[model samples]
Target: MAGTTEPYDVITMGRTGVDIYPLQTGVSLADVETFGKFLGGSATNVAVAAARLGRRTAVISRTGRDPFGDYVHKALREFGVDDRWVTPVERYPTPVTFCEIFPPDDFPLYFYRRPKAPDLVIQPEELDLDAIRAARVFWITGTGLCEEPSRSATLAALEARAKSGTTVFDLDWRPLFWGGEGGASGAGGATGATAMATARPYYEAALAHTTVAVGNLDEAEVATGLRDPHACARALLDMGVELAVIKQGPRGVLAVHRDGRTAEVPPTPVEVVNGLGAGDAFGGALCHGLLAGRPLEDVMRHANAAGALVAGRLACSSAMPTADELEKFLASR
Candidate 1:
């Protein structure tokens, strides 16, 4: 706990691990000769991205009591993201994720979170309700909803937040994590009608407490059972969020506010590299924009630009642009 009494700019809960990415571009994992290790997990990356843009951020999750866990703490401190709340689970080892960098579009990831991930071991009792409620932005993810203790803990945080400030629900939607039969195809693969059915009730519960919702089209479908962007936005708004952001790959992003305001921004063009952490970058920028009280259109544009920068890079956390980099990229466009 870096002793700071002031409210945090961002507090994200869920997911943390080491990302092992192939350094060689456009190569299969089997043929990859070298790899780069970096701190990862959607929530962790978003926290790092926000920290990169000069926001005071912290993440609430758990890690194993091992070297990887130590690495997690070291990395968070290095990135200026608070790790006071990141505790350790004696049972599970820290999760490790590997990916094959297939450029222009395909990036296949293999998750090594067997028995259970320490992140999913985050129990409600361990949460600091005061910190969560006081943050300027509180972010949670769908991946946290796939399992127990974490699912309950996530909801507890949201409930404590009570729609205060910028409460965001990131519909992460990892099918494999949820045990979906379709693998990574059906909502990241936790699929089949049974998986979707199991997830919706929890999504509904989370949305009831969140003010902002963000996800790609596939994630939106998992949350609302709707594929059309407009409908997905409507369903999210109806579910109780004040804002709904739909990320459409290639085409761009659409943001709809309950106050009858809407912004549709096109994707910023960039040669894709890994394309894995773009959404996390966008999420961090979105939190920054919201905290700054920018117009919805400007927020969407800024987020799109941030994401494009990371999509063109190799690593996720390290690839997040600084405030200067984001401005330069936006000005160049």
Candidate 2:
């Protein structure tokens, strides 16, 4: 499947799966309704977003030999993500997230993740280091670091990319994946803060190889233990990253460079629909902008616009704007 003379602009390495939802508006846990399924995962979302934005993108992940796996592969292809490095396994079942979104407030969404999901079995041998080395940027997430073979596999990919001088972009923190204990599942019904505490080592390992680090206000606070966005961004920069971007949601984004420069790019105005996948859109667009050698301010603006577009739409992947759409939005601003 590795038939290409051209190198990809970005290669995403992390989890891939389907999102099974039983969702409705203004409902509670007791007032559930109909359910729908969608193809989703952080790395997959970023890869699709980058591809749709006219960048050469590839996704390296493992999926089960099940119907959900088939759906994920087909969905990635439909979104123009290059799947040459995807490995389909026969043993483990593809990961499926059974989510119930409590309506009206959009905050109390509950998730049921199956144990030993296919994506969790991503071993080092499953990845093609040559393909990883050929990429300009390697996009990764913190959720994938919650498990064993997948964690080592991601680290190996990053190491290969680092040796080849490829820029590593890390989304520093994800509390849900840490579970209860310090491992995959949580220990003793720990709170979100405790789960986040368990994610520190993974974050530190990722930060060691990252050139660009991106996180929202809450994620930033968790990773660096700093509430101030600027201070958090600065702290991340001090950790050897050349660039740090703190996403402030409706407040926009704050970007800081190692050279002592900073900028705050405001988000574009749009109607809010679903906020899912917006961070991936922003991260993907920011990677695209960096690969294109766009100025820092321009990168933030592009990411902000891309994020706003994702927030304004219903479907996760369907909401990602095209390059032309992003350009138009930027020009108007």
Candidate 3:
């Protein structure tokens, strides 16, 4: 556990679990014989990614009281992320995600979080208010707002932080987690607007306490009811964020600052292995660049490059580039 006197570089809240990925690419889960287990979850991966980049990071979440939960802790420690705040929930077994890797485009995820996920049971009273507020960067995700005590806890942390240092709201829109049209399958069953309508208000509430808002076009629309990159950024700014980052998959990222400065960087080319972890990589790098007070354009470019590096790899948390690796990758590009 880190001492209270020294603030961590990054503190991320929400979601922690194990990911069971098929080692064989392009094979269905039904036929896959071997698998690899790693620490998984959006917020958890973000913390690990930051830690990999030499940031002093911790994750505030919960896991089940099972072997899988033990792996979660071991993984966090190995990744250099403080696991002090990640407790165990006795009621639910740890969540596990199965992914079918298809290489370039399609990697379908199957979430086994039925009944309830331990992370979603986070209580507001369990939060360390001072730690959240004191961190250089506090990262929270949209999924944190999808359920009960966690939703209130997430908001409570955001409110306590009060935009201190750098508060990031990652619009991690997982419809399956929301009990919406997507259910458990990879296929889409409804329009984005339908899910957006249910989640926009909560997203807006979180944005009120965030300094930076990041998401793709689909998530942006879910947060602001806007699809246009410029309009979405404008809406996020109006909601109290100082910066808005719109990640347009193929087109790269668009970052808009309230000071009227804007940077639209093109995507770094890579032969993508699993794309799911790219966003988390981008997020960790974004926090790194922002804490260093880099210019908006440089930050976006650095984040883009970091994301590209992860996309070229298979694992999410383990593939996060170290500071040396990131610099080399950027230089080579």
Candidate 4:
């Protein structure tokens, strides 16, 4: 479904759903702990953040004709994201993610995603290709590429956008969403090693279309099998991406461009209330900076500040800072 009008400044294509009951500190599946629901999913979070920053943003994805879907729509609207391109399928229920936030320990946090959720059933026909082609930048996430008609649809959209001169941005590599396969969630029965194998092809497909690539330190290690941050960033750049940003969390961010320039941006120190959506905030701000023609160094700095701000907050979308707030933070630094 191609849109009839010309492209926007930025349009995001990927999954959309709800995150039900994210556990608070010390919460686990065994004992009762406080939980809070937030509009989750990587692509949606970035879209909301970009829109709130006053960008003309649109989202292309599928959701179920259920309460969760309605909530997703309402949240996007409230954040000023254009939802005209979002499709609602009545056959399936919307997807939900349940995660357990453990007490502060040396171990990493754990997450559990539901299988074969509605957001995973997106087909090529469900997308509004015209709108995708009309955008100056098309942003996507690795989680959405972990499944079927949606996977093919995502590739198609990227190809179309590329031909139209739209910059294609990819947040590479999420192993959990890939299921057991090496591709998107691996074959349904996949588990352990088998699932990881199933998700590989989809990852390759995504990498082929990526113009700007972003990932955290662990993801960079997984994606390129390289421990050195600079080498990992260079590997992505060699894969034909114009820019590569490796988010090092508390350590900050490192960016490399095809023009042989590199920038290291330090993270802003803040007490982290919740670490969710920080990557999405960084992605959105990075896109905004690039689209506005800011220098790569400044873009990395802005993105670093945005990510730090989001990480210090408890809510996902609500944690995103306003333009004025972002400016204030920048000035104070």
User: Pick by lDDT: which candidate is best?
Assistant: 1
- What lDDT is reached at residue 239 by model 2? 73
Off by over 4 Å in 3: 1-3, 180-193
lDDT of 2 at 134: 77
Off by over 4 Å in 1: 1-4, 180-192
RMSD (Cα, Å) for all candidates, in order, is: 2.4, 2.7, 2.3, 3.1
User: Each candidate's TM vs. the true structure?
Assistant: 0.96, 0.89, 0.96, 0.88
The local lDDT score (0 to 100) that residue 292 gets in candidate 4 is 86
Please say which candidate is ahead in TM-score: 1 or 2: 1
lDDT of 3 by residue, 244-316 (tens): 9999989989999999999999999999888878999999999999988899999999999999999998889
Q: Tens digit of lDDT per residue, candidate 2, span 1-333?
A: 354667788888877888765556445546666766777777888888888888989888888888888888888888889877777878777776554443212634344445565666788876777777777888877776777788898888777777354465556465666773223445522456876676767777777777888888777776687889989988888777888889886688899998877889887887666667677888788888888888899889988889888876655666788999988877876
Q: On residues 199-297, what C-alpha lDDT tens digit does candidate 4 reach at each position?
A: 556655666777787888666655565768899898877777888889886678899988988899888877666667778888789878988899889
Query: Distance from true position, residue 48, model 4, in Å?
Result: 0.4
**Model 1, 1-333: lDDT tens per residue?**
333479999999999999999889878888999888999999999999999999999999999999999999999999999999999999899999999888888998898887789999898987888888889999999999988888899998999889999999999987677763212334435334666677889999999999999999988998899999999999999999999999998989999999999999999999998799999999999999999999999999999999999999999999999989999999999
Which of candidates 2 and 3 is the stronger one according to TM-score?
Answer: 3
**Which ranking of candidates, highest TM-score first?**
1, 3, 2, 4
* Cα lDDT, model 1, residue 286: 98
lDDT of each: 0.92, 0.75, 0.90, 0.72
Those runs of model 4 whose alpha carbons end farther than 4 Å from true positions after fitting are: 21-24, 29-34, 102-115, 163-166, 180-197
